[model samples]
Target: MASDYWDRYFRRARRMRTSRRRFLLGSATVGIGAAGLGLVGCGDDDEEEPTATSEPGETPDPTATSEPGETPDPTATARPEETPQPTATATEAPPDTSAVPTDGSYYSQVGEPFVGITLDIHRGVSGIAGGVEGSAYSGLIRFDDIPAPTFRGDLARHLPEQPDAVTYIFDLRDDVVWHDKAPTNGRPFTMDDVRWNLDRQLTRTLADGTVADDFTLTNTVFTHIDSLDYVNDETISFTLKQPRGTWLESLAFAGFMDQGVAEQIESDPDVISADRIVGTGGYMFTEFVPDGRRIAERHPNWHLRQAGEEVQYFDALALLDVGADVNAVRIALEQKQVDWIGGRFQRQAYAPEFMQAIQDANSDIERLDVPALNANRALIYSWEIGPFSNPMIRQAFYLALDRQLVLQQDFAGEGRITGPLPWAFTDWALSEEEILQQPGYALNKDDDLQEARQLWEAGGGEDLEDNIELVANEPDAVRLSEWFTAMMNGNLGTDKIEVKGIPGGSILPYLTGEDPIAFLTPVSAWTSPDPRQRLARSYTTAGSINFGKYSNPGMDDLFDQAAATLDRDEAISAMKDIQRLAMTESGAGTILMAAATGRFLKWPYLKMEFNPWRLPVDERSWIDQSDPTFSGRPSL
Candidate 1:
């Protein structure tokens, strides 16, 4: 049955490829598959061979779980005969609040413990706000004083696990509550809410009566939903049409919605009106000003601690939706308008002079580094349209680019031309040699004007005549775009290629599969250590994260086999094949750079864990006024 399904997918994939490139557009036409939104892709080369599999081995029996107290090797093929304790609840108990820190007594200087960031980077929240109306809010999960493992505790309810690529189970706790006294507050979170939200996307329709387009499914198996059933009110079970190894780790994505909030929205479709929130998280929503900010005070009832001991203190969390602009951030930070800021800010905008001023003024600041699973920034051209639609022209463009030169001149030698996967988190990411060994890898970056000319003539470029329009959003992107334009104009010869600049917001329209001609935006995600989630995200027809819309039958079949093989060795073998497939295309993507978050602080009790997707913050990372790190800072 699975083989038949795989064959059907391949048939469709071949059709998609007949066209040079397929343009993916907004939610209306966006198709993320059943696997949800996990990042996935293969290596940088175009011809890497798939991983080898074992000889006939009896498939593991599905009736038993792993033995408790024994950790299963992710790569081992011998399936365990026993079942571990079934996760009966997704929720854990709240921690004792008597030990928490008093707010006023702690020092306010920015540092690891008491860092402040100026967050002015905001995106307009119009149609994209989900259940939260026109209110624009950037998610923040920072807990300044406490560190990792501890921070992971306060957020026990939200974080799920990745035992394998396929199965994920969450059991709810009954003790958490909302800040407001609304009827919805403190009510046990049920499976109904989970199923409801998932179904909403599955069945989403436009105001015009068309099915709302889902964006994740172009190259993944993710559907808005496959099957969602509640074992009980406190436990929820999700069965995917495909096995997703990285689904659990993908939960770290900050924007993953909340159940209670969604249910409220479903009941009224305008539930965000309340200033208070009703989530079962460690913090209570104290205030929420649409498009401005939302504050979350630590739940005195949060359950978490250091090394099994209950946490000693907790602090409030704030969400500030500053337009995410660099100048705004500098002003906001200098004027003390905000505390911390994250997300892709232009590096040049944050010049040495600005950083020096903050540091010299005794500003409590520290930069952060979190690994993510994103492909390199690329000048993605749609091979289906214009000159790029021609394979030779596409190859000509590659020859025109001196990737090393671009890295040094455009990114200060801080970038790398990576394969499909980001390299920061993994030690064994595909190397240049590995990429070359692959079947479809770019053999070299050398310009072959002869080849370019020959292909140009063959494709009728000599008569049709095509020019490239480059697009970018922020200043850095603009700078990067211009650099590429200059290269194309200078190297591609006369009457061959002209490069023009388009604004950043316009890039999304292109990503939405709009005009056949346009520079695609830099797709980003933190890489997962394991390949299952990454592979699922890359190959599944439903995954939102597969932006290139590349699909292959052979790859899809291998992914399915990998996912179903409960044995670790078999799964890993399947994952390697998936990775090789992603790298082969070496599309318009480029891994420009990995970033670390900068923190300006004073307390030493802060610790953070890299979700690769985003930082996981909660009460566990904050220090109380009771801790010794609370020294006062001089007013600016």
Candidate 2:
């Protein structure tokens, strides 16, 4: 999601939480005190596994007004009993291996896979709409799959390259076409659409010469575009202001829209509604009910499918909005009302307890642990705010918090405490030896706390216990925040420490809004292999996603140096320099954990590959026909 929309959604969530009186519970139903809610058992293995061929049932109504099918009320409690479940019985059946296809194609027994997701969806924007759009929309180039960081052509015939390292040439696949729907009318996707999208991103201008202010969220990624020239209907070239090592990765954002649709949306802003948000993707927009559900039917003429073959493995894709109520999502999954939960950038949605509950309830539901490259879980400090404004206080705050203990207690030792860059970037990220040299990253918590107390005293030691507040939104985040509060009060001999927990959607604004002291939240880098985009988004002076308002000339200079060079070694060195400056000197923020495992739950009947870089639940997902309970199979 784009940073601005994330802030906007959090603001909305905060309003909803306050208006509905949805405060964090205190030792009520979950059977644990606020501070005692640490990570417990790893998982349960005794539960019965679900059958792959269970009789297929009717999909839950998207427009239903009641519990089993309706959109979850934001004010609903986290108790599982409060949510309704579908009554689908799973009967044991032998697997039908004979029906399995060997050529990478699988038949779907379920007409359309129902996907349960939690995110803020914006119709007009691409990345801003959250995971649903990420799966439904195709990028020019995309990561192959999880664990593999390599990029592959999705819309383009081949990967685009810059011959001169400053001029990029993209070759379009002629077979690609817009969905056979209105506005685009199944028009052949050409270089014109590509160029138009790129130009709009760069200059925010439509083909008819209208300025589109709303479409400028991605301007920073394509700001280097000096000019775009159409070589032919199938080819376009871009001249950049300078060589960018991550330019190809940036082009993925440009592939989200078709030119015809872009022109219509720009002309009549209201036409950008969900149903009219057309794209040359595998699915076409069908119906979207705000805060309810988004429905997309398979585009019959998608280019990826072979001639005379079925276009989509599933007939349609449904994205349910359970808001930030993770319990509601879990209930829907357990009942088989939704096939899978968690999508693009949704790693934090699964708390440790929730994962354990899913394991205990269903054996057929498998949790895939995917590597979170360039994803960091950290407590961000607002340098522009009160006590955090003082560098000494910022450093002291980092030292006071026991990241290792938090990781063990909150994540069950499934994660490693890290520095500025996540550990997944082994090449560019600091090593254990190097990270130990930095303050607040060392293993000895007692020694760090002593130093933190001394520093706190030196920096005009007022009782910060009562003055400062730590905020977090998700269940795990809330636990971490409360843990930090307890550590400060107990270790530092201070009595006043406050911790507030809200919904995940409310976290962004609390951290980014007016004078935020500190917030516990996770930060994810762009899916690009290069670390330049990540650095630019996090530490740069004009960074759109810099929620903490952390700005340092030294850090900005290092980022600029990294982006200005195409030399791989030089860029990596510059990025490392920026990381060191942000973590150590500038005290931009503290990185509590890095590359923590993310769990994805998929039903036994669903067959799909988990793509960490894209949505975990993809639109191209198919059903395993080898399961004897295949519902759509012709009766023999």
Candidate 3:
């Protein structure tokens, strides 16, 4: 087991080294431009340069897969009623690989007679990477350009039609087609594909009517669904076990897994490659190199464009990871290798001078803070063991944390006071103005400290006589955790919370083990901006991701009341009550701290659609290399 871990570690170290070397060498050669990388077919819509050519590289040593250990559902819901003729033609012409640009990923004509621009942004992610998936894939329902509570159907003509609270139906778009490749050569996408995607997350049973032993439950949001039945070739229906208002919103969370290669790649890691991923989206999957880059080139016959929609300006979309270490991300931004940078989770460390220099050089660049309300900071206690078992101690622990210090240390002082939810979902969340008045989030902390100490003493915290291990998950949380250990001790006038920093992945096993520790981690508290969304994922008794194991009968009742209601106001009332119960009215066991707002230094030339959902790089995000900012990019 340790050997497998080290095997991954050394392989990654090697990649990081190679990435740094390439970036540094590229940085030194500023004038190389797209020309140096052998870019071909940049575009002629605005009459630009050209694109490039490369073999599709599939990484066999995959550390992350679609859903680790997941297999296609063998339940066989229904056979395809009919097979429609495939549409959406791919570019018959071979790729034009004339010149090597300084950034080869910048220009790609893998499957394109497309817009000439190529995008390169900083991204550090596992699996196929979000940009590759989001760009190539089409979901039943999708978030619009904005990240708020706005969404529209992509494959479906509109949001599913709900005939009853427990029943929903989707109207598929006839023109949508699978990407032109292998088993499914640009065939019209249909209802069957939707069902396959749905079943990927649904619980599956063997022919013996027993739940499969190793079936991967990729997502639990679909658990409410009782059954999925085919209505017709273009129509599908879903039956729910019970009525849920947020069910439609949850469908927005569903992404279509291409049926084209279901048998070949669904459960096979050996063949799973980001470049080989096929979907009906703005961009075609091109390539993905771990810790180096991810690329998706323009799809000439993308359904939207086939419908004569004016979208997807960039000839190709690229995410250059370099190495996720803070320096690599910062250097990419500093050198203009990326058009924009910053997010709630990303640990961005940049000097003011570096930012000022960009403004000095590029008058078109803009820096703005985007609220990712769901990306909230949460305090989850080990309620089953130790001091955290006591509610008073739990509350005391939460009350003593200096949120501002976490903001200052981990986020470079660019964040908000998150009590339970981030402020982005203004409709369903407590505003920063209101949250500031909460006990721990208040501008002044004198009363909060006094109460925390009193509670600590009253709860027999001194009896433990040991430093309470507090887990801080993720890199940013780790930085703030080290500082909070000292701050918390000083606040209580006694040594108390000790920082136990761990990677995000390790938090699950540590928390779910024989003796779990209290943890602080980032939660997508605003998954749907539906209050029940968070409750279902993390708060309720049956919650799939409720790592803390925090539960209350009253809280579950509130969720039921909200889900049963069709009245928006009534559901919200119940939702707010649940939020109140999380920390305001009750336990120290679980504290929701709304922390961090994302700030991005965006170049004017980047007309990319950046939303908080999935990865920030939207396929349709406009990229105009002809802009003055493009000419201003670092050249060798």
Candidate 4:
């Protein structure tokens, strides 16, 4: 199933590459996924083939060679049969010094890498605002390496392991310290902090009858944790309600806060004001100008830094609020007003002309593009509401959409038409042939529309009000929503569809309400590499982010079984079943297109680590200026 999916995807990718050279050199840039540039392709033919399996207790190296047309299967990585106990140990392996030049002259010319970045702060910074989660904050565990999902100790000393499938123990580094800010006093990070943070999500109410404002609002991911025990200052344990195969992957969402800060917020929720939010990350929050800009300075006491090493490659980080206008963001990058721009700001790939302008404006700029995992544009229906309440109506709406036309007209043929699961889950995602086999996704628009018309007539026809509103938070979403509205009206002959472009803040209230029948939204499941994390959260009856409020007992059972199964192959099979149910059986939501490969425009002088899953480069990136021709000044 997996190999067949890749075969079709790469074949489509090769077709897009015909114009790649022209798109890159000319003023206009192509959207992501245009030429298989974002998708995985075959390697050299002479490379040795990798073993299909690894030794027990060892994960197969993701970098191993593969056949020309095949990519590494993430599921082939080893899974733990039994949970490993917490051990107070640290891997003291030094950073790969071989990558650095021995001359040290590059560091001298660069001075300090002061990178200025701009983002659409409309999502708001996490902890300070109510809506943002892991996307906006650095969690306890993060995907240290991309394409492989290899995790390294971030806040914790090492990755947590299950003693059994039901229990997980986290061994935190004793040296991790809180920022030298108020309330925290630069104290050593402790298990109490982890316990308090976890408890905020698991236990909503305190023994004293006060509410715990978990602040993060990711309690849905922790619903499986039956209880948490503060074993010691350096150890914390989580007892699950049931076995979960993706429990370790779920830890990536466990961003920690000081116990004192958490308790104070529980007492006075207002204590979590923008300026008061605290975390023990590489960067410390300095200032936030709402809807304008936010700033963070390098923390002098980051625990990850090696002895005698520079505290950080960059002295400070800036997050500018460029608003919802993509053109304004482009202008900012061209003028060198911001050193880099990516993340949600670059969610949609640009037109060829826009790309040309950026290249023409600055020769020093470089593009870093990668295919997004678990990120896609989707049409979300309000299952609990009026028109969408009828499954026939929902199915009719799905069939009415011409996905291929939308991909060409709006996306410039840069996106792949996908199902509920994002293309990021390459191993389990259904192939284009398989996706089209599902109702409404077929290539024959005439046949789909004819079926949709029949379904609509059968589902009360004219009695069902065709009048519906589609809301979008971002510019690209608005464009997609507008295109969909036209298609439904023109093709399906439903003239009552309306499109509304609203601020990101207003999205939740609109979707969770009874007014809007459906909305076009950009959804992502990149928090963890595990498919269960997304499957359970987006489809289950009690899913936290199930905005449409979709519910199904059978589907829930499938997700639960997938989560409980420890074997990789079995878990994958279960996840595939969940996708099949969601796409073929439930029809709860329609995935419009897989997320386009993201493009990051950076100055040549900026030296940064690239992670397709992460954007705008994090704090670990540095600036390099060994070349005599380049200067730190803005090129424009």
TM-score, model 4 to reference:
0.67
Error of 3 at 86 (Å): 65
Q: For model 4, where is the 10-residue window of minimal lDDT?
A: 24-33
Candidate 3 lDDT over 491-510, as tens digits, reads 87777667776764565567
Off by over 4 Å in 1: 1-180, 185-242, 249-276, 303-313, 320-349, 360-364, 367-376, 432-464, 468-482, 491-495, 503-515, 518-520, 525-551, 558-611, 624-629, 633-636
* Candidate number achieving the greatest TM-score relative to the actual structure: 3
Residue clash pairs of candidate 4: 27-356, 28-352, 28-353, 28-356, 29-352, 83-162, 83-163, 157-173
Clash counts for all predictions: 123, 0, 39, 8
Which stretches of candidate 3 lie above 4 Å from their native place? 1-129, 145-148, 191-221, 272-275, 308-310, 321-337, 344-364, 372-378, 473-482, 501-506, 524-528, 564-568, 585-588, 614-620, 624-626, 632-636
Q: Residue-wise lDDT of candidate 4 within 1-636, one digit each (tens)?
A: 323433454444345325212100100001100011011101111011111110000011111112234433545533577544578453344433323422111111101111221121111123221111112233455544433334556666666765676776777777777788888878877766666666655666554676545323233346667887888777778788886666555455456665555556545643323345567766676655544555666667777664333325655656556555668767666654565554322323344455556767776676444444423446777787777778787787777877777556534444467777766456666666788887777787888898888887788746754566676655445455556678877766657667766665565566556574466644543433355655566678887567677888998888777767767677778777777888764456544444443334665545544432333233334554453224544421
Candidate 3 local distance difference test against the native: 0.51
Task: Compare candidates 1 and 3 on lDDT and give the better one.
Answer: 3
Using lDDT as the yardstick, the better of models 2 and 4 is: 2
lDDT (Cα, 0-100) at 201 in candidate 4: 52
What are the candidates' C-alpha RMSDs?
Answer: 15.7, 16.1, 18.2, 14.6
Ranking by TM-score: 3, 2, 4, 1
